[model samples]
Target: MTDFENVMIALPAHGHPFTNLKERSIEIIDHHQERLQTIRDASHQLIEGTVTDYMRVLFSERAWGDMAESETYAHLEHLKESGELTRASNNGIFTYTNTD
Candidate 1:
């Protein structure tokens, strides 16, 4: 299944069913942040061009470096929120994959 579908399914399956919504949302944010790092690293390895050719490079590298990790993490979060990025299946070796 797609990562998005996995998240959708796993969330409601979470324990007790009615725990703190805020805390669960934070947990989702944290999950997305980790996914962002993995996706970013993969993109860095597989794609090549000017910095702008990559989505994360729209902002300055140093500026991105300066932001708190959560804020920096939000860059990919917003793309996700806005439906700009997505999960795709791997044709071969990779899992948790995507395309540009």
Candidate 2:
């Protein structure tokens, strides 16, 4: 079997439904899209920003304000893990996009 197929077979399955998780993810992505646009619009200020810049913007926002830097970062990491968005792979900086 191909390496990709072997890896997929090794992964554990989720016994429960993921509908709520998927819905939450969609909401988070929608919110994230707006936050991303804000950061992009203020791009001039972030011309020299690193991955940290992206995290800072996200953490400071109202939607994610209740979350600590580390916490929000964890959420973003989950998105990357789920193949919803790629992290820190754009312009050598932390940028993201939908899988499509």
Candidate 3:
């Protein structure tokens, strides 16, 4: 067997339900898209922004207020894990781009 198939066979299957998790991930992605659109609409510009800049807008609107830098970073990481976004860090600064 191939190495990829061996790994898959060895992995545990006791985690969350695949369908439910996929649905939840889609919901989160949709919400994230709406937030991105909000930022674009308010700025009247293209849908591209740095994390700091976007977080400032979110904080000003009191939206996702509980999410400070770390929380926001974690959420972005979750997006990366779900294959909804890509992230990279340069000089300790993280940039995210939506795959869709």
Best by TM-score: 3
TM-score-best of 1 and 3? 3
**RMSDs, each prediction?**
12.3, 10.5, 9.3
Q: Give lDDT: candidate 1, residue 20.
A: 53
State, as a TM-score between 0 and 1, how close model 3 is to the true structure. Answer: 0.42
lDDT of the candidates, in the order given: 0.46, 0.52, 0.55
After superposition, which runs of candidate 1 have C-alpha atoms over 4 Å from their true positions?
A: 1-16, 48-100
* Per-residue alpha-carbon lDDT of candidate 3 for residues 1-100, written as tens digits (9 for 90 to 100): 1223223223225544433444455676888777655544533332344566556665655564545555555555666687866767778777776666
Candidates by lDDT, descending order:
3, 2, 1
Model 2 over residues 2-97: C-alpha lDDT tens digits?
223223222226454333544445676888777645545444455534445556665655544434555545655665687755555565546544
- Off by more than 4 A, model 3: 1-48, 61-67
